[model samples]
Target: MGRHSLPDQYGAGASDPRRRARRRTVAIATVLVLAVAGGTAAAVRGGLLSFGSSCQDDPVRLTLAASPDLAPALESAAKRAREADLTSDGRCVAVTVSAREPYKVTDTLLAGKDPGAEVWVPDSEVWLQRLTATGGTADVSTVGHVASTPVGVAMEPTVAKSLGWPEKTYGWLELAGAALRDNSLRLGAADPARSATGLLALTRLSTAAAGVEGGDTQAAAMMKALSQRISDSDGQVLDTLPRDSSGTEQGNPRRNQALVVSEQAAYAYNTAADGDRSLDFFYPKDGSPRLDYPYALLEQTGLTTDQSRAAIRFMSYLDDPPQRRLLERHGFRTSDDEVPDALVAGAGGSGPQPYAEPAARPASAVALQETLGVWTITVQSARITTVVDASASMSEPVPGSGRSRMDVTKAALQRALATFTAEDEIGLWDFSTKLDGAKDYRVLVPTERLGDRKGTGTQRDRLSAAFGDLAPVPNGATGLYDTTLAAYRAATGSYAEGKFNALVILTDGRNEDPGSVSRADLVAQLERLTNPERPVPLIMIAVGPDADREEANRIAEATGGSGHEVSDPSQIQSVILKAIVEAASRDGQG
Candidate 1:
């Protein structure tokens, strides 16, 4: 059978007619759910998911972890489900909810521990993408988005009025410029590494600013400016806003007058703060990215058949009209088209604000990576040792890129180098079988501050020249294992205490040096070299079709890093940044 299923649901299996109809429109992201029943879908077709007609067979109890902000609303909906005695095939469906930060939860799951939940309702699919991006396949499946809210800049009414908020619409860059140019305007945001809201806004700002003159420089400047007032998380960033709507506290360096936040957050804050302590919102004319709370089933939770079916049953209950109202009352929109007038007003949006307009398309996984990379580098800086494969295979032409892998890889690396500031420390290495004296790797540039003067110019200048000089050594075979081990040792041995220390290796082929150390030995050495007190993440990028992703994954994972596969070298820059941000977030350094 060219198919997979949980015993029954397709071909020989059946499904609930009502459920099939309702779930047809559910937002399916990465996972497809097949309802499981003991040997037959008939029992599931009935209101009970094959459980006996008793409420006390331990009732299919499921635990869920939800994004902090969305947790309360989900709890309310779950409470209603329990009160209504919602059941899966006559068994009671009991779901317990807990609030958890998305980044922390993702890190927890990636570390291969029980996240203490069978279901996860993250604030956005972006977090889910991060999981799938690095791990190749995430062990989670999305049923539907329970609720949504657009991300926008929220400001005090007085400050918003001064900028012509209600009547005048602004693009992301225009609004960002306003915040930067006005001395009285203090703009803040959540650290992009931790908050999808902050990352999306920053990504949009980068897009908007790139269309203008001096884009790279301008974008870098904007990132630096925004980083000055970044908070650790969404909740922390909100706390930076003035306590009152009067805008008097906006003058204080500590209180931000404007912030990157979600519409629902603005609504909730306004409703609770009331009178003079309310906020106004500016939905960018271009489009506001949104937080779509996706109901994800954590597949690795060891859930029983009954438990899995019961989780789906609860998700179905959330889709009902009553639960939709519960989400809205908690300051959210069930769908983009059904904007509530009172909710919009309460969220500090009014006529001409584009509040009812359709949401902007979510940024691609690559875009999110680039945005986060920029934020991490600009704010925290880094010490990176980039190792490139100078193996003969790198000379092969990429299918659609019209350039050899080596050519494109070098260009991408240089582009990535440009995003770093002079304060950052960077180095370069090239490897191939028997490159020098039977050694697989040779350091072309020692890791040093980019701004530090060397011979006739700075270290950055020297490194750029070194990158351009790289070429596939004549008939050089890949020496991946030995090169990786040597680089890992170098990176961790010199871990810069105050900076993000990392080793980034870009390879186009698997280990071709039979004489090199065994894969098991290489991984063992890397594990021994890795230390939390002196953290150094190994970011391995396998380029082109010939690169070995599984090998890369095995070796990189030993050092608390990840292996990524790119079809072409053009994606190298974005991938590098993404890897760094992932490492930082895992360390809770965001």
Candidate 2:
């Protein structure tokens, strides 16, 4: 109104056409500009824009439970993930890796009640599938493969040569025959409950022993035979390795012990063995099981700030080429990429090591079922002898420790005795002046009377009482070799068909009664008694400062069993459990 200098005769009669058109155009232009600006702002607010001004601040932390078998590779992969910065929110992520048995880990991961981890890498894919099959609201996704290797008999070249290697594929029968027949041959594998690799190996052996094509017999006779050889429980096995390796090699060749290990470990060991050549790999002729390391993503357990970042980062890093190369250098095959030539050359001096089958063997559903069935049926027929060294030396307290060696040995044996089901045949042998009670070392009772099949409290109470009553008897020098002979003789007298036989020998000192029963003589006797057709395995547990390493090795070597040396009383239960696990199951599945 104030600037109406051009008020033409457009007032009430007619409108200014150009003015109206210009006004309408201005309104349309304003609307168009607002729509464009708001859309642009919305895009920015919604995070669809190309440039982001801010990011999540907190770091993600991932807790990973991995099978002990793949601990090495996963550890290396974890290191690379952090370096590559492939995290979920551009923040640093921390990965905490814990190594445990594949079965235990899978069971724990599947239960999913506690604050769960962000990821789990088991030694076998079968575990992953088994975990998922156990119904749950959570969805644990299987990440890309990690590493693979076939189970092999780890032995010295000389031993392998004696067993007829290179010229023929080494089957479990040959190994079993050697272990049972020869007094010098030594064989060892981890407790099935403690190691996926060990379990796979046992499973293969059980299948071969039963002549079951593609089926794992849980109750197979071979399983019982194998189980009888485990000297300690799962926890104890881990500790025993270091204990047995105690005291540096310094001019002592007997200090070196051979173990059936993963391919990567074998490679590392071979590289370090130098001129000693004490360690070598033995691929079983019965077609070894492929190790399909499965890294599964745990979805339900809310990740820590760092875990979320680590989970995404680790996966992305493994998918990258350069990081994959590092894994290969460490004797691992990448799941998504080709095996590096260097790795191939390292494996076999030429091409990649060809397994009996492909690395990614499917977890057979029928095979698993058959194996489980066999385990339930066959577990009971095994006869177990718990050998305890009640020699005077066991009464002496461990130097700088609280409990006596005898007490610790009893605790371990008690724990092992508790794991036996009713169907099993069990007996007890206390070696001192002579084998206790059972007239000249005989079976105490059929295990069925001990407890219910469901593993009830009744059995626990009976075992506890039996273990508690073991008084520390002050006797003459520990007669390990003699005690072993007496026990074996007693076992052969009443040995049953279709039954697994084992002697669990616990000692705390050297075998000093060499005048009448020398170690060499005892070993020869054991060889004759444990003839391949009637294999009777022996497991030994050495306790106290004076425990003879050489003697323990002799017994284990002669019997195809495992021997363990213990210093810590707390770890006894684990050691005994592993031995029982080894004796009860075949091919590690049981």
Candidate 3:
């Protein structure tokens, strides 16, 4: 789709020929008036407009979509440019600036939908990175940066004091721990998938939780704990904070202590406060993500000669000294690293101290993609039934671990359980020849809330106990086909709403049951039963060197799921996490 082409939802009314003709007539009249005033000739003599460019009688019209937070400033600049009679080759340049969410635009572009904007000024370059990584059609080129804001935590003054604020150095882990330990400290962030600040916050929080070296189980648990507090937007998150006493309320039960937001947003909130209930900024010691408002030109939109020149001229106008100062008034630091003293003080920084910049560099494309995937799993609750193979081969000793395959697998399952939040539902099942009367699979625990149970400890304890109790049935054969079909049927029948439902099968051998249905029939049945709207990804983890990877992959493909093979049983937990992330990506949830 062309850059100017609106999505189907917006219809073709805006692109109607009559509308274009009207716009052209108005533009031509405006240019003629500007030329009569001598502004066009003076600008041309000043070398502001390229001499060789087309000199159409009509002014060029360009559309610019900017992040909501930055749109107001950009619109002001665009208006000023039009009033100043900014032109390319004597033809006046007019720009229309509109507010748009970077994530939504990126999604639309990646889906092969037209964004209807010649330029995009997103809050950060992250959106551009994501677009390129996801195979967007737009050939984007960054013209320059307009403003910058770093991601930081906004806390009520009293809360900051309690946490040792400016006097103490804290990173993401410390902040996350405080929230998890104190029930009253309700930490909130925007949905990571849609907000750059939220996404950066999550990336930092997850990295901190996992530790620099990765695979920190306790940290992963903390990350999941943090996800439960996510809000829909920065504004909604700020609303949870306490307001000043001019009849304004402070934070209530749902929102209390801290929020993840951009530095500019925090400044805006503090400046609007009527009392001492202002929010203080806390830049993470480890590093924060900085949002550099990048001005990108959509080159693939097939811009007309006049439109292209108009876009260039307007971009130059926005970067002028006067326009930069205007942007500073709106709480953004200029591209030249210039921040006003008054703005700094308003955001809670004093004379000798300035708001801290991001300590860590921006994430690589691959890292950002992985972080988003992990965030999806953290937010979307899952209903999973773990089916373990307890056939005779499970008792064989693993090569390097010096432990039986079953023993290692059980240990990995126990570790994996810790990564899930309480909101997630899980169950346990075991499969072997004739395990339940003539059946190959039997339920060890019924699916229920991770935090729900009849007895003292949580459901996790019950699951761990079940895994520990699994023992290989001597002389038993693998009942892969029938057990898988039955499990899939059970999962589909009991599918929960607003949750990812799946049956995770871990096996060390191929199907060996003669009484089972044929492999082709099983694949066909699974394909026929699959539903895109109500998806239940069948994840098959082939364990040990002897496992059949090909058959496992076949089953997963038929059900819109995934398959993974692990030769080292000790790596099972990590592999399981990877599988879950991959499944989430396949379902387009991340």
Candidate 4:
């Protein structure tokens, strides 16, 4: 259940069906045995299918997909439920728990399919927001948290002693920045794009860093450093910690003296480790974000009424005294307002440390999007080709702001450009009728690394100048269809693997050029150019009232892309970031 749980083991191999059948039979047997003291052994010892069994055969069997960290505890709880003869409406209830990655499960649920589970227990509420944000047709409802764990810096005891852990306190920014400068403390974290713990911790760190004078630079520097040691998931981050007392694994560069991990993870490690361990933790003075394990029901699929009731019944059963004890033993807080002394101490905390402080505020969708965008640019750098419309409609000024759509959009783009690092590859293009003699689009910059050398300066410099120079043609008509096809073709040709590859189109109107390719032909060409092995998701931003959002969405979907609307072009960067985060997630998960 902890690290032993595999990511994609839900509904595993040929034995899955057999396992379910066995569980049904065992459920019936367990109910029958409760009627008599020795019927269980008597029936099993005799190898009896049934000894004049009068057992009413209806049973509620449910599959619960839970985060790997909580699966072991839930499995134990399920076994206890069965032993107690727990039932819903006179039918014996049984639950089969499968360990799964929350991100992958969220992707599956949003795709409007059964994720091989009737109920899902993801590690945080953020996953719910992510699932619902897509406007998914599936009806997955939250049933509240089963357990929780706070995220903080977990360090080896020696390192903690040097930092005055038990006596002195530190904020996220202070500790994280100090780690960046000090060579002794090798800091590591899970990729924020994937792990909630990482994202929450990074958000807190970012917030703290921003309050200072030179915050932007500091935050970017810290993220770049952390990326060198970032793990794909929370469990893998645990793997990066030092295993022995010496704490000197010179051969392994991945080994870390400190990490950003949840209290439950620290507790798990401390329980198994020797005296010298990474149990020493520092709960920052500012605040720590908690992973609230929400028990959500996947009611969109084959969830029967009985199965739903049985799931609810099991949820209640988890609140029982024994179940509570089980959760406590595994180092989880059932309530957010209350802090468990034993659990915190086990994860290495003391009275002076601000362990009981109120948690950090819950992150909003916008904050999450912006933070993830920062990651995509700085650490998980992307390959983006931005195509802007130069039609005459774009020349009109925005209602509230005096600036034209092109002006606000260019400023927003330049700001966005600063977020990206040298590792990122970006290109620029502008389009309208007769913009490139006969062609509808003209490439302002070729797709290449921002770090690469251009004429005098770098690619980033060339891109910045191009963005500033963008202007709308006086009498030009929209050539959106042709531009989309051309940009997508070039983007696919210059695809960079292991990066968030994308084509961004900013337009104020639909295709108005009679010579342009038909929408159907453009979509087909985009679809053909979109390689599953090397995907290039086109992000189309309809910048003003005149743009056709439906058409943008239709074309974007053909290349596994997304469409967004920006009444105020000032919000384009935020929209692009959110879209990029979604696209990157799909790329990794697929």
Candidate 5:
């Protein structure tokens, strides 16, 4: 206002035409220049005019989710990178690290949900494999490894001494036998389905058990025994240890005897104990699974070029010599060929040495899936009603096998029963044309608790006997629709609390009985009967090439389950187990 004030004393100039014209032109020019300058200043204030029309000073923000145990080192490295003025291209970067459990993160991704992270640092590559198996949308690539650790048992020094720790060698079977034989030696482990270390331990146990005669039976029994000592998380499992007592050879007898965890975790715990050496890790002599901490870049749809560059920069920073040393200090091996001296000392070793015996072989995805299936069965007891088709078609011999389809199926079912625990409740039914006088299905065995055997033998024995006695009626027709509807209704009506309630239907042909319900009506009724809060999954195992797999799938889909088709009855065991696993995975889903 002071510079552009119109002269109040210019009355004469206003009256003079030429003089007024000249003053007006000059004032207009000045007003235009002022307006331009003000607009430029406002743009600068709004961060729209920085770096010559490019806002390069603004830091690109990146979010990284890392496993809870490894998050501290990642955060420290992030802070150091920021202090060092790490940038992406010509722009500054800001990274925020969050601690999240690997399993929870995997579940979120598998549910077709984004975790709002541009980078993820899972404790093992197994999670990525699982994600891929589940058809997750997140495209991830491993940039590099941050640290390495192996799965092993962490035990009290006293227990180790009793077991002849450094002087004696022990494998999974030896440890499992000790736990089974001695109730006083309380062994605890994390849930295998939820923890990589737990999964590795369980796989090792399964592999060891599979080598012996009657392996599946022995494995199931051993797993059931160990299930009693399982905890929800690794930290919880370690918490079972006795409180430290200064200068004592033996810990409190009340504490847990041993726990399955990663070598790094055990080292961290011992380090936190201030060199008291109360706990030490025991690498099973047979072998162990190793965790290679992979830094994965999650390329989400919304991720920008700048963010991607920033993630790469941060990943590279983690692999640098300085940050690698930081990882070593946290009780992790930074290299594959050589163990760091600090990690060796932290793990209670005198000199550099291998963490654990080299793994016999990496666990395959299929093997892992099967292991998870077994674990699911062991952890939760199922209430199942099995319906078998006794049509004439079932009497046909399986291709390349001398046994009839019915015989093969019955044998498979008998074997499958061994995987179930004593608490699981099971029933048997056979369906054909007019099997129960007016009814299409007949109950061969009443549903009862497997462990109960008051009048007869145990439920397992009764079920086995009934299965062996099953014979397809001559000239019988399939009653697929009516029997499925009736079985589903019965299972739902008698659904038990705190257990998976479901129907296991094995069929070899389509509905051939004219008096049975129509397929459309059955599917519609099933859809209407489905309740998300109280699920009664219908797992259909379709055997032989003639089985109506499409109808089976439709019915199962309506009730939040799945259908598995086995072209050969001899392969029914695998198909049945797969169906159980799929149903378990969809337990909480609608």
Candidate 6:
């Protein structure tokens, strides 16, 4: 049939009572089905689907496009649905799970436009609004609350005590003041634009600061402060929060993703992290926005018989008592039906939760709103950049270094990539020995390639693999000058649009033959890039006994970036992420 032709339910001759009653639904479904059929047929015609099964699967496959942040909860929900035999409801329901970065999942689902997958569960409701604003066609009525948690600082218990935890209601003022007072105080949070939790955290802070809770002004101010803080730190604090705070019993979180994430993520980490129960929660005194993850069925897309049944069944299972109990066991808040003692003990509920009605009256929305407004004005941004050192100093192990510079670089790079998000892109390149016969240079992936695709998870996977493949390759002298130039060119290439770029350079020592570009010449180029018209930020990182610290400073000064020196290789990753977070703001790429 042609694309415009309606489905069987909307056929002109159809006059059945059931069909008429569901006319609007049938019309919407017909449109979605035809679109899918057309796309699938086209894909098959072009050999994109690869198999005929894409067309044959009309029996109905329920695809679930969800945020990676919610993987733990929803996966549990799917398991429950399957155990209950929801798949046998004559619809041949199948749940296909696809993971995306938190802020991007909604965009991904809309792209597919299949509507065949009756349900989509994102990490936050704010993102759902973003999707809808972008012309979401689905019936939003199906959207319902599924799971939620508040944003809190996941810290080592010792760290919490040092920061004056439960005894004094740890709030943003204390947290920020402590970090400012003590250089050793490490703090972490997610990138606001990248994940709901991060955005919510920013919102909470903004609301508290501006005295305008949950408003755009608060969001803007929070973005500004967040940008400044991120600009200062460069981006290290957020990178190590999860792993450093995780409980050891659950296997260590793979170094393939960022550390500071949602409460659910923190829970997963603590569950897997094998260490002292030293980890604990630190809620901001202002009362941050709770991470409210919702599951909504898209009415715009017509679900296959199986998908329709599966979606409803899954929702019911989520609200069921047994499933709620399972969620509670995993360190999440138990349901109102039954709060497990184990969960209560683990959660350490010192205050009222948003889910259950409190024995005492809950805090007023006006009070909470006022606090959020204040937070928004005071929020700080987190900025970060990953720099790799590929100079000659890296070829050999230091006499007292214990490990080769190259080895340290690879390990640090791997750790650094794991701490970044689609929102944070690190410029990558390396300098090597240059023989008269050949050019000594290597640039892995440039900064622009990071998170280029709006909703695809490819960038994350690509970065993970690249970091995985990095190893000590001894070859040439350091080309810090030339590579920095390349990075500068990439970051500042489009200055007219008013972009904030940070150049993070990893170097073992001073620049050798700069490939015709003298040190002075390179500095001038950096100056041009950092011009107020362009404003390219710089962060220079060095590791080597004889490293040229002076040169690092000069490079950073040229671009208005910072220079950091670290002797301990183990701490480099956190330092970089924290530094970046301090430097970048919510206005910039948090």
As a TM-score, model 5 comes out at 0.82
Q: What lDDT does model 5 reach? A: 0.76
The CA lDDT of each predicted structure is 0.83, 0.55, 0.76, 0.83, 0.76, 0.52
Can you write out model 5's per-residue Cα lDDT over 1-590, one digit (the tens) per residue?
00111222211212235754784687567656756777756655775445332222477788899987788888898887666556556455678999888988888887778887988988888899888765567688776777778787777667777877666767888877776676767788888877888887888887888788867777777777778888777777878776655534234544577888887888788788856555766777787688877778777547787787777767766666888889877877777667665665566533112353454467877667667777777778778899999988889998788989999998988877877778889999999889888899999987788888867589988998999998988999998888998888888888888887788899998889898888889999988888777788898978888887887888888898888788887666666666676677777443
- For residues 115-163, write the lDDT of model 6, one tens digit per residue: 3445676666666665553345546544466665556655566555665
What ranges in model 5 sit over 4 Å off?
Answer: 1-56, 87-93, 134-144, 246-254, 348-356, 395-404, 454-456, 469-475, 527-534, 568-571, 585-590
Error of 3 at 336 (Å): 7.3
Candidate 5 positional error at 459, Å:
1.9
Question: Candidate 1 clash total?
Answer: 7
In model 2, what is the error at residue 129, expressed in angstroms? 3.3
Candidate 4 residue-wise lDDT, 14-43, digit = tens? 124565577679867775775577566665
Inter-residue clash pairs, candidate 3: 242-250, 242-251, 243-250
TM-score of each: 0.80, 0.49, 0.71, 0.83, 0.82, 0.45
**Candidate 6 regions with alpha-carbon error over 4 angstroms:** 1-60, 87-92, 109-117, 134-141, 180-182, 212-239, 242-261, 299-302, 334-341, 344-590
* Model 1 lDDT tens row, 282-347: 999998998988878888888778777777777767766787888889898987567999899989
Worst 10 residues of 6 by lDDT: 1-10
The model with the greatest TM-score is 4
Clashing pairs in 4: none
* Model 4 per-residue lDDT at 98: 98
5 against 6, candidate with superior lDDT:
5
